[model samples]
Target: MMKVHNRPQNRCFFLFFHRNGQNIGFAMPVIFSSEDGKCFIMEFCIYPEFRGNGTGKECARALLHWAREHGALYAELNYGGDERRCHFWESVGFVENGSDAWGEPLMILPPTEDVPITVEILSDPEDWQLMKLENGFKREIGENALTGEKQKQLQQAVKQGKITFFIARRGYRAVGMCSAAKCYSTFSCWDTAVFEDFYIEPVFRGKGIARKLAKAAQTWCAENGMSSLTVCCAPCDENMYQSLGFDVRLGTTFAHLE
Candidate 1:
C-alpha cells in the first residue's frame, strides 16, 4: 500500500491510503462562516465501508478542535433531512436549521425592475473599499461581531474562488453589495449575504434598491451555471425575503454559541 498526503490551505485534511486502494475513504474538515467570524460545516462525508469503524466521529471531533483552535466561536454541520444522518448530527451536538438539501426556509429575493442602479463584479483593488462598506453594513444589520481578521478571511475566500462579490451603485456611491459562494453540490448558490449597507439608502429607501441588487445577483448566478439559489437571514428579516419569492424550508435548525 502506498501513502499519500494532500492538504491544501483552503482544505484541511489528512488522507492515507494505497494508490490502488479499493473503497478509499476521506475524512476532511469543512469550513464556512456566519454573520460573525464563527465557522460551520456545510457537509462532511466518508466512504460507505468506513462508516461504522468510528472514523467519521473521530474526524468530526478533530475538525471541531481545529475550528476551536483557529478561534471559531461556534461550529455547525448540515445533515440530509433524513432520519439517519439527522440523528447522527444531533448526537454530535448539531441542530438542524429546519432546512434540507436545498437549505430551504432559505430567502429568495425577486428580480429588480431595470431601474437606474448599475451592478458590476468587484475588482481586486476595490477590496479595501468593499471591506469598509461591508463592515458598516454588518454593523447596521447587527452582525458587528465579526473581527477584522475574520473579515479579511472572508475577503480572501472571495479572491480564492471560494466566493463571489457583487456591488450595486447609483453614480459614485455604492448602494448595495451581495456576497455569494458556490454551494457544496456544485450546482447551487449558498450563504448569499446581501450586506445591510446595500439596503435602500436613506434617500433611496422603499424604492426597491435591494430588489434590484438581489435580482442582479440571481442573474449572475444563473448565467454562471448555478441552477438554484439560497440565502439565510435572521428571523426578523424572513418576511422581506419571503416577499421576494423565497420559500422558507422548515425542520432545519440554526444556533449561535458565545
Candidate 2:
C-alpha cells in the first residue's frame, strides 16, 4: 500500500509505502505549513522481514526530499530514548540537535559521509587490559575485574585455538568486541562457528563499528574453512546483522535443566 495524506489544519502529512506485499510497518514523511515552518519525523518502522534491503534508507531519502521540497526551516527527528535507534538518522547524516515536542531526543540530518572504523584480532598482552576494560561495563561487573581464573581461562582458550576474539578500536582504546568459536552444525554436516559477545560500548554504538567487526569475523570464518557462522542478537540488532549478510531467523526458546 502506498498513500499520501495530509491534515491541513495541523499541517501534518504522512507518506506510507510498503513493499514485497508486506503490510507490517509504517513510514512517515515530513512536511511543513510554511517556508519557515519546521519539520520533525515521528517514527518510521520497516518490518523485520523487509529491513536491510534498502527499504529503510529509501524511505529516509524520500522523507528528506519531501522536507527539502517544502522548504523546511530545518529537519528534525526524535531519536527515542535509546541512541541505537538513531543509527539510521546518523547514517542519513543526522546529528544531535535538541529535543522534539514530546521531549524525545532530536537530530538534524545534514549532508555527510559515514565515519571510518578500525577492527583487529586481539593478540597482544596489553590488549588484555582493554578487554578487561570492556568487560567492566557489563551490568554484573560494575567496574570490578573478571575473576583471575576467568582471565586465565580465556587466555588458554586463545592459545589452544578454541576461540578468536576480534576487537574494534578508536586510536588507542578498544571500543567493542566480537568473539567466535569453532563448532559443529548437524544440519550442515560440517564445522561451523558460533559468535557471542558482539558488543559495542554505548559511546561507540552508532559509529558503524559493529559492521567492521562483523567483516573481520566473516574474513576469519572464510579462511578457517567453516561452513557458516551463527550470531544471536537482540531483535534490535537485526539491521546491523542483516547488513553483514546474516539471515535473520526466528525461533522459540527453551531452557536446559542442570
Candidate 3:
C-alpha cells in the first residue's frame, strides 16, 4: 500500500507501486513554500526491473502537475548518488549541478586485486606505543589522529567483530599501523600510517615496513571474508599509496558543519 502523508493546505505524496504480487517501488514528494513560491519533490525510487518502462517519467509528470495545481512554482528532485537515475530525472526536466550540495568531488574505485602485507595484531603496551608513533606521521600530514575515545571505541568494535588492527614492527620498535573495519557488505582499510619517527630509526625505514603492515591488514580483511580493501588519503599522498598497488580513485567531497 502507498503511504501518503497528506496535509490539507500543504501536502506531500508518497507513491508505491505493486505488480505481479510483488512490492516494487516507491517515491516521496515534499512540498515547500518560499518567497519564490512553492517547490516540490524530494525523492523517488523504482526497482531495477520496473525502471525504463515509462513508470518513473509518468509518475514524475503526475507529481509535477499535482504540485503546480497546489500553487508550487518549482519542483525539484535530486539525483545526487544515483548515476543510473540521472537520465530518468533529466528526462523529467531536472538539471544537473556542477557541484553537489556540499560541493565535494566524487570518486569511486571498482573491485581490484588486493595487495598483500604482513602485519601483527598489537597486544602489548610497547606495541601500542609503536602504533601511536606510526599514527604521528598522519598527524604530520594534517590527518586527524584517532582520539583516546575513538581508540576505545575501535577496541570495542574489534572485540565485537567489527574490525581488526595490525601493527608492523622491526625487533621491538613499531614502524607501521593499519586498521580495517567491516562496513555492511564490504571491508574498508580505515587507517594505515607509517611513522616518521620510525622512518629515521635506522632499523625500520627503507625496509618495506609500510608494505608489510598493509599486507597484514589485507590478510586480516581477506580472512574475515572481505573480497576487497579500500583506503583514502590526501590527494597529494595518492602516489605514495598507489606505489603500494592501491588502485587510486578520487573520493567524494568531505565536509563538516561547524
Candidate 4:
C-alpha cells in the first residue's frame, strides 16, 4: 500500500506503489459544475508496473472524497469496453451512465440519499418472518427456488451479520424486501455494501417503492460506515436503479476461480 497526500498546487495528486521513489502514477481529479450540479472529471492514468496493484482504485476513492467535500452532486468519467479497466472502476464505485460520441463508457457516482419509505433492519429474522423474502426470490427466480436447499442456512448467516435483511412496509404488511451484505474489497481495503435480494411486490412495482427500499438499505450500510453501496442488477432492472442515482455495471461480468 502507498501513502496518499494532497497536491493543491496542480489540482492533482501523486501515488507511488511499484516505484515509490519516482513519480509512478499521476491522477489529476477535476470537478466541473453545471446548472443542475457538479460532475467529477477524473483525468488519470497508472504506470504499467502499477496497473494491477490497485493504484487506480485508491486514487479514485481519494478523488471521490475530494468531490464530496467540494459539494459535487455526482462524479463522471468516460471509458471503453476494457474488462479489466471496467472491473476496477465498478469495484471502486463508478457505474456506466452511457457512452460518449466515441463509443466510450460514461461512468458516474451519484450522491446517496434517503427515499420516502419506512424501512427497518431486522436483528433476528425467523423462518416465519422470511415469508416475504422467500416468495420474492421464488417469484424472481422461480416457484421451486427453495425446493432443493433449505433457506435456514442463509437465515443463520443473516443472524451472524454476514447479511442484513430489510423490509419495507405500508401500515403493517411487508411490501418490499432487500438483502444487504458487506462486500470486502482487498484492492481498496474497504467494505463496499451490496444489495443482493431486492424485491418489491408486483402491485407495488411502479410506485417508486423499490427505489425507496433501495435507499433504505443504503442508508443502513452508510450508517454502518460502508464506503460505497452496489447492487447486482439485470438489464431490465438497469433503468430503475439508474433513476435512483445508481450506475449501471457496464462491461462487467462475474467469475469465480476454483
Candidate 5:
C-alpha cells in the first residue's frame, strides 16, 4: 500500500519532471475534491540515478505548484513515520498532521493565497462573534469551564475596551482570532500591550491566519501609540512569536494562574 503501482488511468494525471530537456522523474496526482479544491499525490518517482543531490526536492516543489495551478487549495500525501521522510517533506512546507483510515500518516500543504481572509479589530461584535470567542475559551479552559459568568465577563471586557480582539474571518464565519490587553508600564511611563488568547479553528490552521492575526494586533498597537507589544509563551512557542517580529527577548515569565 505504500505505492499504488496500478492507479486508475482515468482519474490520474501524470507529470514528468525534467531539467535541461532530460526527464528526471514522474508524478501521479489525483484531484480528489474538486469542490473543496483538494488534491492527493497518488505516486511519485525519481529515476534511481537522479534520486538525490536536490533533484527530488526541486521536483516536489514543482509538483505542488502544478497542483495549485490545477485549482487545488490543498495538497496531501501519505507517508510512514520515518524521520528522514518527515524531515524532507516538512522542509518543503508540508506539515504532518494526522493519519488516514489505514493509519498511514498524512501530510498537507495549505493553500497559497492568504487573501479572502479579512482581519479586523472589533469594537462592536455580533452574537456570532461572541460565540466564536467563547469557543476559543472553551478549548483553552476545557469543557464546562466556560461558565455563563465567564462569558459575560469576556464580552464586557471587549465592550469596555479592556481588551481588543482581532478576528480573522472567512466570509461570514470567524476562523481565527487573537486579543490584546493594555497595561500601564511605570518603567516606560507609557501604556504597553500584551497579546493573548490566540486561537484558530483546527481545520483552518496552516493557512497563515495566525500571522494575519498577529500582524493586525501589532499594527493596532502601533496606530494607538502603545509603547510595546509582548507575549508570554512557552519555550516551544518562542520561535513562532519570534518569527512575527517579536525578536527582542524579554526574560522568561512565570505566572500564578489562581
Candidate 6:
C-alpha cells in the first residue's frame, strides 16, 4: 500500500503514486505557505521503470490537483533555466513568470484551467498587486513607481473611492495593472476619469491582456455613472488606442515643472 504523510512543523507534505502495490513515483517537499496561499513543488520524480508514455505528466496533473484542493491558490517551482524542463512544465500549464529571491528561474501554475486571464477592479491594494504594479512601472518608466509611503497614501485614496485600480491576474499572480483618476469634466458637466499607467509584464504582453484591462476600466466608469473615460496617448500609441475604440480629436502637449 502507498503511504502518505505530512510534516506539519515544516509545512511540507509528500505524495506517492503507486500501481498494484508497486511504487511508481513521488513528489516530495510539497511546501505550503498559508500566508500567501502558494504551494511550492520542490522535487518530483518518477521511477526509472515508469518514466515513459505520459506517466510523469499524469502524476504532475494529479499532484497539482491535490495541491489546489488542499488550499493552494497556485503552485510554483524553480526550473534552473533548463529549456527542456521548462517546456515540459509548460505542457502541464506552468508559465515562466519571474525568478525567486535566490535568482533561480521559476515557473507558476494556476490552480485550474478555467482561471483564464481575469481583470478586476482593486478596491484595496494588496501586497501582490502592489509588487506587480511596482514591477510594471519600473519596466515602463525606468524608475520606481510606488514607494511604501506612497503606497500608504494610495491605499487611503482607493478606500475613499477617489481612484480605481484595475489588475489583470493570471491565476494567483498579478500580470498587469492600470489606474483611473476620477475627475470632473466641465465640458460634459459630468464626472469623468483619466486612464493612466497601463502596463502588462513583458512575458504577458500581446495576449490581449491590455485590452481586457482597458475594457474593465471602461466598464467600471459606465457602471459607476461616469460620463466618459479618457486616455492621453503618445503618437506611437494612437493606433493602439484607436483599436480599443478611442478617437483622436485633438493634439496635446505637456510641460513638467522644474
**In model 1, what lDDT does residue 20 have?**
49
Candidate 3, residues 1-258, lDDT tens digits: the string is: 133355553456666656677766776665554323335355666788877778777766776676678666555444554676676666776654222123211111111223233457756433354435434444444555566675566556657755556666433334356666656432244433221221212223466776776667667666767656666666776787777657647465476899
Q: How many angstroms is residue 74 displaced in model 1 relative to the true structure, after the best TM-score fit? A: 42
**Ordered list by TM-score, greatest first:** 6, 5, 4, 2, 1, 3
lDDT of 6 by residue, 67-138 (tens): 878877778888887998899899999987654433456677745444589898775565555555555465
- Return model 3's CA RMSD, one decimal: 20.2
Worst 10 residues of 1 by lDDT: 102-111
True-structure Cα RMSD, model 4 = 21.0
Global CA lDDT computed for model 1: 0.53
lDDT of 1 by residue, 194-255 (tens): 22234433334566766777777678777877655566677887888777655655434577
Off by over 4 Å in 5: 1-115, 140-145
Residue 16 shift from truth in candidate 2, angstroms: 62
For each candidate, give its TM-score against the true structure.
0.45, 0.49, 0.40, 0.50, 0.54, 0.59
- Of candidate 2, the 10-residue stretch with the lowest lDDT total is 136-145
Candidate 2 shows a clash count of 1
lDDT tens digits, residue span 83-153, model 4: 77677778987765433323344565644533345677765656343554555456456454443235667
C-alpha lDDT (0 to 100) for residue 142 of candidate 6:
55
Q: Point to the candidate with the largest lDDT.
A: 5
What is the Cα-based TM-score of model 5?
0.54
Q: What value does the lDDT take at residue 257 in candidate 1?
A: 85
**lDDT score of residue 51 within candidate 5:** 85
RMSD of model 6 against the true structure: 7.2
Better of 1 and 6 by TM-score: 6
The per-model lDDT (C-alpha) reads 0.53, 0.65, 0.53, 0.62, 0.76, 0.75
Per-candidate RMSD, Å: 18.7, 17.7, 20.2, 21.0, 11.3, 7.2
